[model samples]
Target: MEIISNEALSRCIRDAVRAELQEHFKTGGSTGNVSRERLLSKQELAAELGVSLVTLTEWMKKGLPFFRLHKRVYFRMSEVLETMQQKI
Candidate 1:
């Protein structure tokens, strides 16, 4: 003789239904890239390197490690990484 408990049966059924629903949604849902790679600006560059915008402005004033393209300012990511790694 064997007996099945109501609680155990309900738990097993609930888990099975959840697994099936997951499989069903997996095919219809997105599986693509979601985020965009952002370019670093002066503010972001300063934050990443633990420096302030004022410090960046001073560097520019001193003519140290800046990029000027077509009359606009830019900073190289590699240079920022190096500056972060280097001791001040």
Candidate 2:
């Protein structure tokens, strides 16, 4: 058994994480691209914006763009950001 220094261990961990992230990106499993806009749940958006679900519902009533498939609602992150920017 060989002893590894703290710096060497840290570097090894960093390189492993970097390679995993790169592999994830290559497999289209990471959110590193803006072109691939993802639809988020109302709860997710509310948490992301630090707002309540009721407030999000109010925004929906006030013309916040959303998609409804059956009873579920989805919002595109990019569209939500753009709309919020326009509002401000």
Q: Which candidate is the best by TM-score?
A: 2
Q: State the lDDT of candidate 2 residue by residue for 6-74, as single tens digits.
A: 899999999999999999889888555545677899999999999999999999999899999899999
- Model 1 scores worst on lDDT over the 10 consecutive residues at 30-39
Shift of residue 75 alpha carbon in model 1, Å = 0.7
lDDT of 1 by residue, 1-88 (tens): 6487889999999999999889869865445653233446777777877889899888768554566667666676766556646736
* lDDT of model 2 at position 29: 82
Error of 1 at 76 (Å): 0.9
Query: Model 2 lDDT vs. the true structure?
Result: 0.92
Per-candidate total of colliding backbone pairs:
0, 0
Best by lDDT: 2
Give me the runs in candidate 1 sitting further than 4 Å from their true place: 1-39, 81-88
